[model samples]
Target: MNFRDYLLPADSPRIAAARGVTPAEYAQRMLATEKAQNLQREWQTLLDEAFRGITTHGKPQPDLFHLQDEGFDNTCAVNAARALLATLSDEHHQRVCQPVDAQQWRAWYNPEIPFNDFGVRLEQTSVATREAFRRLLRSCTSPSGFEKINHLMDANHFLGELYDLTNIMNRWSFHFMIFGEPSETRPWGWNIYGHHVAFCCFIIGRQLVISPTFMGVEPNIIDRGNEHDAILFTEEERRGLTLMQALTPVQQQRATVYTLMEDPAMPPERFNFADQRHLAGAFQDNRIIPCEGICAAEMSPVQRQLLLDTVAAFIHILPEGPRQARMAQVLRYLDQTWWCWIGSCGDDDVFYYRIQSPVILLEFDHHSGMWLTNEAPARFHIHTIMRTPNGNDYGQALLQAFQQYTEAE
Candidate 1:
């Protein structure tokens, strides 16, 4: 099902009525909630399977012969040590001591820190070393004879300390999100913290040469598989790129936007000219495009003609421009004429395609605008859609363009 379908209201009165109740009460009353529950169950099943393999292969215990104490055959101490070591090597120890890096450590230990703050801490260590630190700390312990256990603990917790600095940095990086007077502040802070933690954990795993059951489960965790196995891009990338390609040269010059798409099922033939219309239709039907204002004031008559001509060739043409003057002002924001594309899939039938590129697509409804209802107070909407090889949504074609453009240079 489409994402919009999920967002839209259902026709069932029982379901519609439930929406009025508190989320807790609604969940208790709805059958549709089972979908989420079922999905969770499936996720847990996969996790259990992956964990089973990790435990069976990654258990940290010694062999049966090693369990026999060499010097303390008669002492109970040897047996105790063997038991302790076995427990440590058990599945739980590896799970807790899972390799992590500075980013993942910060995230797992200090999610309150901001990105800018985290970046500062990251500056103190190389990505590789930060990962090593996470592994060391995860397994570190103070010996009984050590007089400076406290100091040792402090040293061990340095990664967490660095994460604290990240919190301060984050506050500065996204001051607007943090300090804005909105009643409900966005959880950008928490999101960054979680991302950092995951990234750190990934780094630790990499340094320790431990493999995660999932891809991108850790930071710097490169996917050694084919591009088709990646998950970074989504349908959103395609929609974004389509709009980006339609922008006039002036528009491309000013704005800096990045698009990312993740679709594993995207075959090479999907980029052919014959498939362009189908792709364009998919974007439009999905309504994944974001609406943003465009200024077309700066375009000379010839430039405007070129844009219209280029766009006209595509099956799906998104209109551009408010007036000649507005187009000129909008052209100053775009930075580069580049796009990125990727595709990947999962173990299931699920698939995705991602396209990251420059594009501008904006929408403004009347209710949100300053002016109340007016007879003709600019009630129009502006849309800029493109689907040509050069116009955007041409993933495979762009590769060819890049090669040709580079060869010519």
Candidate 2:
């Protein structure tokens, strides 16, 4: 029999009573609820099992990766579950589920700012999510391991953010539906939906390029603006501003932010001081240099090289003309200060440079294209980072870079 044939009817009074709705409404609600609940339960079960395996072993198991594809499926499943819950009368599911309070709803819905404002403590929650994801990571033994499961947890986290944002936007939409006539608020609601869709695509697509196995920087949401003005800035912006404000006057004018990953064994001071003066000279010559405050952390040299090569190749393969010029301009900006560098004790350093000013109040993913063979084709894999002009407190580097350029004359 077809699945629908065996499905329970929605018009049943019993189901309605249990759901605190009329018999007709209950029947329809149950049909959707039952299916959604079933899927949710199954996915949760798989996730739980995966988590158990990882915690018990303290290392990822091979089977865990197999379940990574479920990340997308689980997102759909959760959405369905949320919709099913919405159909039920609030009276029925008061214990297990409650409609988000105004404060909670606000926190959940607003994506323009960081999660802290909403009281969603990521560090604490991630401990649990990370453990669950650990199991999923252990399962990958194939070449596709990174490609398949590496970013599932990050994607899942993003989905959670999306869910909250959508819920908030939906609340606004409902208000319009009730009051009658769409207005500016209504457009805002639609924009939220569009934003969420775009973000979802970005998060999912980015996973394929820099999965957990690759050891590259993970994307993070540093700052999200208020609902009325939702904007996202890059991590580059977050760190750059601080560093810029700390630079000397001469350095400030000529300085730009560059992100470099050096061997952990190499002292950060060594990398920063040793390279700063020389790089500043290069910048005077219109050459790109490392940013101040070099961040040296543990990362695989091979992974670093792959990222750099991909970016370099991206620069080399662009079509000639206006597009190329624009790309070049962005490249020069990125190259001047934005650097993703990796090094090992014995291996050569690998670096990726960009001249494009990092987008502020927006997220850009580099992983989506039909050309699978193209370098850096994995667009969305790079985590969200931001760049902005130095504010009063943190823009000295911008001044330094500029001053250095002037002194060169």
Which 10-residue window in model 1 sums to the lowest lDDT? 204-213
lDDT of 1 by residue, 10-51 (tens): 454533433344323443543245654554353334433311
The whole-model lDDT of each prediction reads 0.24, 0.24
lDDT of 2 by residue, 176-290 (tens): 0001111211100100111111110011110111100111111222122433221122232333333333434444333223323333565553333212212211001112222
Local error of candidate 2 at residue 275 (angstroms): 22
Which residue segments of model 2 deviate by more than 4 Å? 1-326, 332-409
- Give the TM-score comparing model 2 with the true structure, all chains together: 0.21
Q: Report the number of the highest-TM-score candidate.
A: 2
Which prediction has the highest lDDT against the true structure?
2
